[model samples]
Target: MTDPAKAARRARHDAIRAQVADEETEAAEAEAAENAATLDVSLHLRISHTLDAELRRRAAAEHIPTSALVRKLLAQAVRQHDACGLTAADVEEIARRVTREELHRSA
Candidate 1:
């Protein structure tokens, strides 16, 4: 028979492992969907080293792939541009707010 304390600890570990596995499976499915939807969507962008570093850092902090982060940012940019022809200042402000919100959610 399992010892009570060990049994409780094992239960917690098992629960966490199961949850992580479920999350991983969901993420994989979502990624597959994202890939299947992109057709001739190849984009090559050149940016300053600083920007690249920041993007990599932010993506890591959010626990998402850099390509996924870039896709999300591009989608937001397109929507904002179409909605109002957003100026540089408007885009910058919106980006800052969005970054904060994303980081807060991750936290």
Candidate 2:
């Protein structure tokens, strides 16, 4: 009940679609691999138990890993021009302000 030429054309179209999808998936995986390769740096640090608990609490509150929270804070610190001039109190103030800002922004 179907025309042979029409059936053949449909088959070809389906095959082409499948091939394109496969190629796209392959390209995406390759791009992810390349990105992961570039971001493969590790850092380790030792801090007081108090700081560790605080970091874990903040990370949990933000629904991110502790490492991610630390990275975000460090990134913000790195961007500050007066970071070298910061005292302990100044650092605490900055951390509080950043935490508030992050919460407000996410809200």
Candidate 3:
């Protein structure tokens, strides 16, 4: 015959373990949500003629497609921007500030 007290203790232990597991799952989900919120999203830019020309030259020099080169450069820029503790807005503003310098350099 099973001991009623032992059965009750086992039930309580199982319930406690289940609750702990549920809490951990909730915490993990919250963390995943936070990380997703911090991830950078992709963008499609309509490049000006000068920018397109530069991209074509650069890509040809590297023997890669223009689109691929743009994607690679943009990914690197985003990583560097984030590494410097800059938000997307900061990156955009900095890029805008440097656009003239870049265009002149390309010219």
Candidate that would win on TM-score: 1
Distance from true location, Cα of 63 in model 2, Å:
0.6
The better candidate by lDDT, 1 or 3, is: 1
Backbone clashes, each candidate:
0, 0, 0
Clashing pairs in 1: none
Note the Cα lDDT for every prediction shown. Answer: 0.85, 0.80, 0.77
lDDT of 3 by residue, 1-107 (tens): 47998899999999999997876676566556645666655667787999899999997676555655776787799998888886899999999889988999999
| Regions of candidate 3 where Cα sits further than 4 Å from its true position | 1-43, 86-107
User: What is the lDDT ranking, best to worst?
Assistant: 1, 2, 3
TM-score of each: 0.59, 0.41, 0.39
- Show the lowest summed lDDT stretch of 10 residues, model 2: 26-35
Cα lDDT, model 3, residue 43: 68
Q: How close is candidate 2 to the true structure, as a TM-score?
A: 0.41
For model 1, residues 5-104, the per-residue Cα lDDT tens digits are 8999999999999997887786677667888898647889799999999999988676666788888898999998888876899999999999999999
Instruction: Give the least accurate 10-residue stretch of model 1, judged by summed lDDT.
Output: 23-32
Name the top lDDT candidate.
1
